[model samples]
Target: MVIGPRQDRRPTMNDVAARAQVGLRTVSRYVNGMTNINPEMAERIRSAIEELGYRRNLAAASIRPGQTSGVIGLVIGDLANPYWAALARSVESVAAETGLLLTIASSEEDGARHDWVVERLLQQQVDMIIDVAPRTVGRSWSHWSPPLPPVVFVDRPGDLAGADTVLADNRGGTRDAVAALLAGGARRIAFVGDDRALHTMDERYEGYLLAHAQHGVVVDPTLVFETSHSSGQAVDLVARLLREGRADALFAANNRAAVGALLAFRTVGTRLPIIGFDDFEAAPLFDPPLSVVAQDVEAMGRAAVRAGLDRLQGDDGPARVQVLPTTLQLRGSERP
Candidate 1:
């Protein structure tokens, strides 16, 4: 038989994972000094290591040490946005309760910047991290693994194994809201929001599609627009949709989208029933009182902090994902 790549090359963690018949994460955990693994699984990993002559860097820094820096790093998207600012405020409150300081960084929705901020936080030796979201949760943080500190993801679910995540019931809330709006009488509701690359937007978009599926109504694909994450982008897209006269109602994915929709409608001197996700400070003051699917920003912050604390306090359990509920606050919009 021809020589296999494994036979000619230095064994790696990937090789160990295959030989041990376990996930790469399990192999990683055993090699990276996390001792909470099952004993049988541990033996398999150990056996693989010995057979492969794989050398573990005895001096490699563990993901986290027994000591803490009394600081919790917070990485969010666009701190200037009211929703994000509110989340940061709530996180600070929980951090203060535990005699910890918060180190905040705005990713500006940039993947490179998000990675840079994470590296800088590691250099500063923050106790742990709580990130709102980065580019794409499933693959964004794949670069940092073994030595990365514990992270609790908020606003979206992260793909990291054993990491805690706190999020709103995005799909469920949107489904309920859209279903209710449909039950009322509005058809041809347009979905306007951020790009689908974002996990939150993807979930909400799914909710939008599911609602249509439930109603047995075919969605006009043209009515769905995934614009850039900006007020200007939303305004332009919504204005174009308005000119087309293709929508009877609007479903805004987030607060900024909602604001843009309102502004666009005002400019045209026309109105449609609008239901948006995320509540802003001025929603109550709107002429017709904006309706929304409101997520508990404070609760999300608290849950993320709690999970981070648990990880620091020797809780080696599996990752805890908390999905808080959302309420449909109907004022005068989204009603037939």
Candidate 2:
């Protein structure tokens, strides 16, 4: 039998102590932020820690009584989306204010992945969790029993009971977009969106119908398309609709679908009226600037963090939902 060094092992505190020529207690004190050590000794320990690349185990430290992990876990759907990215930035800003570390995970709207990420966050003993629930996973929190840490839902609310939720006004935003198109003299407006199973998509679709009804304009079922939230799929769907000349204007329910529709129109050298939900980068730079229904993403993020903090502070009140408003930003794209 041959014996070799353990290549997988991380450098331990004992290694740091030996390198610093200090007692183990001195190393422990330095790692724990104790101020009783001499300056010279502290310098030696710091140098040793740097040289050995020592990292304190936050999970182990949090296990001690009265010690908190000071970490918040955030789970979002599709970090690639600009809306989700902005929301994350807001959450990070608030977490910084509280001096808590934030760990972010992308579930990609997959139920299994969302569950797995939540379990991992719990294992790390995070102070709380902020999540944008997966489209298919309703009531995900029911799987876990009592003593669960505080959780706040953002963007989309799942069936998690007694948890606070923060969401944009999806239905009203879409309705406003449709109404604007109508006022601009668009008689045949097309609606493109993600799967209807998602709460956001369903709400937006409802708003589309309501806007048409209010204006005494009947919607054409053929002009409305629902796909798997893919930009390429959206491009293909919108291209078919354009080829058929079915719509005088378009309402894209989300950012990705909007980009797809834009590409489809650009491909055919046609500039039909368009309005989209969720503003993204360079939206104003198009040939005709894209109009959008803009949500206060940063405010939503801040509100989520505040709600989580409140729960941590022993506010056992009934669950609350915060529905923030959206605004229409017109830059000539809504005009026919």
Candidate 3:
């Protein structure tokens, strides 16, 4: 029997196609994760594939004509967070223009998870990397570089040591928001944000301090709240502040923390003026509409992808820290 490896060559797509009585194109599409496979035929093809021990040579398939130029790997802190999700969508859209597939992985704000995700993407030979909200990798990223792909930081700014970055105008926008609040008669404003170790968080905090100094408003260190970037912790801290009567206005540093503080305020039935860093859904629908420093999240994503593609095309463009502008929108929450 021609059963040993020496006698029987490994099963290929052709063998599976022959066994399933399906066209080569049908089997090809199934293996490539493409759609349009009927349920019954898909089941039959899968069974035949298993029976024949057929495995796709992904490396070979990746370089086929009209096939993917490998994947554009995106690593973000959290997919549930709207900023990262919007960024991922934008990256996918831009990558589509270059005929590259997008593979997104969420680190959930953990440094180890971020490292693992990037390593896995590297193993798969992604064409490029985009990291949004990376924690500890910023300083040492240059030391651990990928062989073929270049890494780009998105949303959260970092000194990636030669890596490109796309970030929102965090400091200027926060200062503007604080100025608006001061003008609205909000004297007792409290700052709530993530750990100061984060680059964007630190920048936003600096803006807040700068605004306070400019307006001759004293920074009451007692009113500043810092959490470990936890949604529940943000909610708890905001709720505690409301109970203690420390703040008449709140400035949320990031979107998730902002949403959590909003939820806490709603639960407490407080209508204190609130301005969030990132605009979110249903902000206008709340009893008191929310004021926010809104970044062009989609644009940031597209810019990151564009930068990566440009580098991939052998462009000797200067490595830039592209900071998109942020807008402060007036809402009922900031009106009074």
Candidate 4:
């Protein structure tokens, strides 16, 4: 309907319901992305929203004062990243058991974007935040000050001043994999993937150094390469390293990086011993399978939720760090 000469109030759910000729519940369900609403009813709600120019009361949905609000927010670097997706599902499952609502936002791996998402969640009066922010791209938890939500850092290295963090056993895991490669008579191993700014990267690289040091081997700096974000980049970088004779064996920082290296080796008809940080779904199905240090993602998820809840329950001092153990999945990739 067109606006008349008279002043009009902002459109509410009631107005939309009236114009759509549907019950308030029907409109509410449609607006919330719930599946119960029939197609006909959803269309009617859509038309009414257009006619009445109704806007959602986001501010009202936020800020329920002086109580245990059931809402929690998650800020992830990328929704497309499988690791993040798995962790997100686990967090939601655990939170649901306690009747808390879980909402997620993606930062597209940008620090500024993550900051905006965090602020929005804060406005929504969420009890806590779980973030997958890396130390790279200038992300630091210290930037968040005053009335901050209890925050949990997962997988990525945090700002490091003091924040609750859950990470894998990087040094031990990497050291074992490198030892296996050496035992198989493979030398000239190269480390690939991830920028130097991330604590995860530092830990993995330190593991590489430790393994060689323990064996009285020296690292060739030229063999280390930082590649793209996903496994595809891993494949390309590994291919180049092999082509240039960088190393006879490779240590991939994560699953994606390992997958890339495997693909690259296959393309060049080379079967080098390879190891990765995280294991993939089709790891065992690879031509030579794939060996990896696997973190218990579900356990990590549960721990993050527990940490967040503990903070929400009024333990707001300096943050704590939690490290979880990782298991080695021995596959053909790390074998001769």
Q: Top TM-score: which candidate number?
A: 2
Quote each prediction's TM-score. 0.78, 0.84, 0.79, 0.78
Span of 10 residues, lowest total lDDT, candidate 1: 57-66
Which of candidates 1 and 3 is the stronger one according to TM-score? Answer: 3
Worst 10 residues of 4 by lDDT: 1-10
- Please, what are the lDDT tens digits per residue for candidate 1 over residues 257-299? 9999889988887788889999888897897999999999999
Q: TM-score for candidate 2, please give it.
A: 0.84
Q: lDDT per model, in order?
A: 0.84, 0.88, 0.80, 0.79
Candidate 2 residue-wise lDDT at 110: 87
lDDT of 4 by residue, 1-336 (tens): 543222457888888888888999888778767987888988888988987778777557445455445777888767677777888888999999999899899988777888788878877878778887733454455666656777788877566454588877887888888877877777799888688677777788888889888888888898787654777888788877778876888888877788777778888887678888886587889877888888788899999999888877777678777888888888777875
Give lDDT: candidate 2, residue 251: 94
lDDT of 3: 0.80
Candidate 4: misplaced stretches above 4 Å?
1-62, 138-145, 160-162, 316-318
Runs in model 1 deviating more than 4 A are 1-65, 136-142
| Tens-digit per-residue lDDT, 1-336, candidate 2 | 322224588777887788888999999999989999999999999988887778888788876755678998999997788888998888999999999989999988888998999988988888889998897673458887766678999888867789999999999999999999998889899888888888899999999999999999999997878873788988988888788888899999998988998899888767689999999887899878999999999899999999999998989999999999999999878886
